[model samples]
Structure formats: C-alpha cells, structure tokens
Target: MSVGVRRVAKGVGDFVIEALGEAVGEFVLSLLACALLGCLVLVAYLAWSFSPRLTIAGAGVLGLLLAHGAWQTFRTSTKGRRRGLATLTAAAFGATAITAIFLLLYGTGCDCW
Candidate 1:
C-alpha cells in the first residue's frame, strides 16, 4: 500500500480503538452509578417504611434489594463472562432505584404539590 494510504489506515484504527475504550469506560461508570442509586433506594425505603412496631415485610424488601445490589456489583467486576446477567442486573437496579426515589419523594408528601 502507498505511504499515504498506510497512514490513513493507522489513523482510522486509532480512532476506532479510542472510541471503543471510551464506550467501555462509559458503560462501567453507568453501572457504578446504578449500583449507588440502588443502595440509596434501599436505604430510603428502609427508613421511610420503618414503623414504631417494626414491620417484617419492609425489612425483607430492604434486604432483598441490598443483596441484589451486591450481586450486581460482583457480576459487573467479573466482566469476562455472564454479560447478559450483568446487563439485566444493572437495568433492574436502575429501575428499582428510580421507583424508590419517586416513592420516597411523592408517596409521603401530599401538600407539596
């Protein structure tokens, strides 16, 4: 190949590599953010739903969410295999986090509207 063609090919290859690296970095960051959100949600739910008599069901749900968040963190760190499971866990965590946040914000307050 001509020198100019070789240089162009090399530039394109570098661009593709950099883009892939950025994408992977963004994915990992997103996963971490989701995990944090899940943790926050679990905490909020436990706090909000706590009663003077201590409800067992509320505690159980909090435990489940906490365990799921931990499991997702494990799967995400071991990224060599089980990509499908990791993705599902991350998505679930994000959805649960959003739900919990909304519930905490709106479920208790009535006159804030």
Candidate 2:
C-alpha cells in the first residue's frame, strides 16, 4: 500500500477510536446522572409521603433546587455530545420538581385567616 493510503487508514482508525471514547464517556455520565436522579426521587417520595408539613416543604425546596441545577447542567452542555439525552433527563426532573412544588402548595392551602 502507498504511504499516503497507509496514513489515511491510520487517521480513520484514530478518528473511530476518539469517537468511541466520547460515546463511552457520555454513556457513563448519563448512567451516573440517572442513578443519582433515581435516588433523589426515592428520597423525595418518602419525604412527601411520610413527613410533617414543614419537612415536606423542605424536601420540596431541595428537589426544586436540584432540578434547577440539573437544568443548568443540561443547558450548558456542548453540542455534538450527549447533551440531548442529558437535557431530556433534566426536563423530566424539572417537571417532577414543578409537580411536587404544586402539590406542596396545594396541600398547604395558603390562606390568611
């Protein structure tokens, strides 16, 4: 094979390897994020189901904060990466947080006597 052809072949191989590396990295990151989100959701559910009114409020606030952080992370992720999946997960979490906040408000019934 010609030297030019050999160089091109090696370049293609290197590009493939780099792309695979990026894919693996993104996969791992997404998995970790999902695992963490699951744990948070579990804890939030427990709090919402069993806690006192004041404690439920605290948990609601915490969930909202975490969701906001996830949204920011999603938005700041660069293009051509796993940003789309991460953004979707963030949206799910954001919606959950908003729902929880709404439930909290509804349960508390903000009224001045």
TM-score leader: 2
Model 1: per-residue lDDT, tens digit, 1-113?
99999999999999999999999976665555566556766876776677623555666765676567657755546445546655566566777667767555544432322
Candidates' TM-scores?
Answer: 0.43, 0.49
- Give per-residue CA lDDT, model 2, range 1-113, as digits (tens): 99999999999999999999999976665555555556766886787778679677786775676666576655655554555555565666777667557445442342311
lDDT for model 2, on a 0 to 1 scale?
A: 0.66
Regions of model 2 farther than 4 Å from truth: 60-113
State, as a TM-score between 0 and 1, how close model 2 is to the true structure: 0.49
Residue 87, candidate 2: Cα error in Å is 29
How close to the true structure is residue 15 of candidate 1, measured as C-alpha lDDT?
Answer: 100
For candidate 1, the lDDT comes to: 0.65
Each model's total of backbone clashes? 0, 0
